[model samples]
Target chain A: MVFEEINKKDWEAIATYLSGEMNQQEAVDFEKRVAASKENEAYFKQVKTDWEIMENLKQKNTFDTNKAWGNLYNKMEQDGLLDTKSSINKFKLSRLAEIAAIFVVGILLTTLLYYIVSDTTKKNWQVADTYESPEIRTIKLSDGSVVYLNAESKLYFPEAFEGDVRIVEFEGDGFFEISKNPNKPFIIKAKNAEIRVLGTSFNVNTKAGNDRVEVLVETGKVQLTATKNKSIHKVLEPGFIGTLDNNNIKKEINTDINYMAWKTRTFNFEGVPLKKAVEALNRAYNVNIVCNDDRINNIKLVSPFQNKPLDTVIQVLCELEHLKFEKQGNNIVLMPK
Target chain B: MNLILRRIQKGDLKAFESLFKELYSPLCLYANKYLQDKDKAEETVQDIFYGIWKNREKLDIRVSFKSYLYKAVQNNCLQQIQHHLVEDKYKQYVKSEVAHFHSDPAKEMELQEMNEVIEQTLDSLPERCKEIFSMSRFEGLKYREIAEKLEISTKTVEANMGKALQAFRQNLKQYVGVNS
Candidate 1:
């Protein structure tokens, strides 16, 4: 077949057709034209490459606006943009008010139940010591409750469980194995949510910006409630996960034990988002990962590996996903196939 | 610059504060491109600067301040993404086998560079072409949407897109390796 001369209009038409910006009829006509000649096939490939480049370019320019605002706030704080003394005063006053309210409530409850008030004094709780390094630490509570603190995690607890229940506060990711104490329930206070349990094993991850506090139960049953709203309470059974976000509680059946696998260095992921997976790798291995493909960043993966070397992981990923990786010192770069 | 550096080296709170103000937004913006979630991105950026401030006295500014900021932001963002991946992997142990892979870093850089190239190319185009292209692509408006935004007819939108694409392709073909 004789090859027709390709003009600038032809190139634009091909670009539009590939971009899916063309009308239905226009696309169909363009496809027909491409199918008519070998030259058209070659031209289509060229156009396709050009279009991919354009898409890549556009994706790169779009930055997350929310992050920008956060940076500004932090900078202002560091620069002493706000009155430090006033801010500290405000914090102290709010804390004092909270304590006073708790005291008033405690007094009222004490009057109603003298026996419960007396029992509160005998409880012993011990919190884990603070660690300067970002290392996952494990603690065994007095009541035989086991807690695994993620890197940079902090926990606060009393010397021992007292009164009607056992309470502990955590500010980070932690996994718990509560002792079977039906009479004295175990309650974990993490940010805006609370996890209550009666002898159960579960993972509670309350990372910042994660609107919901996630609870994945491995054994027994767990109850999750948003601290801000008592009405939002969810009961979760073994192989179940619950989330409390925006004062809303959502429960979903989850049979995956690997979801709580931070206790082990091995990470088992299934259809996890690329960005999320990268985050996990960095935290687990303390390495930097830079993605060259924005589209791939959102792509999900399904794979399981145990304590694999980072290079091996990257190699397997590249083979399975048809992707490429470039190492620049401590940083690993991810690119498309 | 040397005086500011000396103050930062000495752990002067004021000097650190001033530096934070100057570099915070750009660093955050840079991190946002990698991690799409705004809150997470912000947290990562904040944590980095806070870490720097806490260790300001020991920090060695061996290179341009820009390089140091970029390096810190890059490391933090990458770490955040990798941490999530490990969590997902754990979640997958009992569940069905599925994998989530991140984009290639080289490709991301290439794309960023290409974007810069495209922006320059667009700037060189006629004002009407640039506006139409931005309206159609950036705003994600259909031809009709672009027409409405630009107060032009659908035909004009189509025509302008065509022109813009043609100009872009001609300018970018070499970089994109688009040879027929």
Candidate 2:
């Protein structure tokens, strides 16, 4: 009724508000004006009705659905909208590729983790104290390497092999069976000699007065360098004996099977000299033996001594050589009857 | 979620028709907002949905089907306006100024009056909003930095900042950001 009172500018603002274009403040301001007066309220209703009719006319009069569909279908035929399963197959192929990439990445990660764990296992070592004893001492190293220290020997080994080499300072004797690690070499540091071996079992001995050191190889190889003269070293093979003395260093095929008798206490000597048998017995028992008569040189002992007591072996020797024996403190004197 | 679109991609004509019928008029009206010519707007929308049917198999839409259609119509409208730059009737229409009108002096006087009203409204803002707004905009500090300075959580700062921005929008209709 009072549509004329609501000016054209006011109509545009009302239309803007109807279309959700007015911000909160503008909408509130316009709504307040409508609520204040009956004329403004009637203008609001009229504008809202006009917008509703316009939207309906847009769908009914302007958009002809059938005509548009006909045009779209003709255009589609011209464009050749193909019907096939190729696109589906393409999606499947891409999915397979994704799975394959994930598999390869998984393998790479596992290999990397394995190397990291194994490298750490090999590189880390704990600290331990040094080792020495009078009797034969079997020492298992922190790195699982082992050395058998013989009696009358002083082996001042590192507490743990915390380095790239397994090392020990030696004075008397030892039989070493080191674990096989090519990275960490086993070394014997002696008074007159230095013996180095990489993962092998070997015997080491130093005579009284600290004059000599002997290394006999059993498995793998051994290299003995004279401490007094470094250039004087020998690389001895299995069944080879390397002797390092104050003045000389030499290696020979180990034919003296009794060279291990000090550790084994077992011997098979056939027609060996009287003095030779006594020497084997003395070494096996750690005793001193003196054969004072010249006639005993012609005597020969043809027998096997298998872990026999020292007194029995000596009695057998004295009877066969027609000799008498007297026992001294840690000593035995043999004489012709 | 795009089940109808998937059917359309498989050459289902009925699915395509349902889609076209549901969106046809609304899309035309949206395009007319920028083109200002109902016939051109209808033609643009028909071509877009027609192009959709032509290349249905290659339609790789990540967003909702309706939103994708609306966005495609918007872009096409902008492109047409750019190509026909000499046509001045629809050249100045931007998406942000959807229902704005160029009035003689009445609207200008209204905007001038709006500034005074905003000054009164802004000066009378809630105490908390006034403090948060000055700390953020006037002091030129980041939300997290402001939170740390004020000894509050970042979420509390964000909420207060939203309150302040809402207050500004209530006074200044053209002001944007913080939701822009």
Best by DockQ: 1
**Candidate 2 CAPRI category:** incorrect
lDDT of 1 at A256: 41
Candidate 1 lDDT over A112-169, as tens digits, reads 5844543465355445633565566888888988888876677887776666778888
For the second chain, the TM-scores of the candidates in order are: 0.57, 0.51
Error of 2 at A84 (Å): 80
**Model 1: how large is the Cα RMSD against the reference?**
20.9
Backbone clashes in model 2, listed as residue pairs? A128-A159, A129-A159
State every prediction's TM-score relative to the real structure.
0.39, 0.38
lDDT of 1: 0.69
Residue-level error in angstroms, candidate 1, position A326: 5.4
What value does the lDDT take at residue A297 in candidate 1? Answer: 90
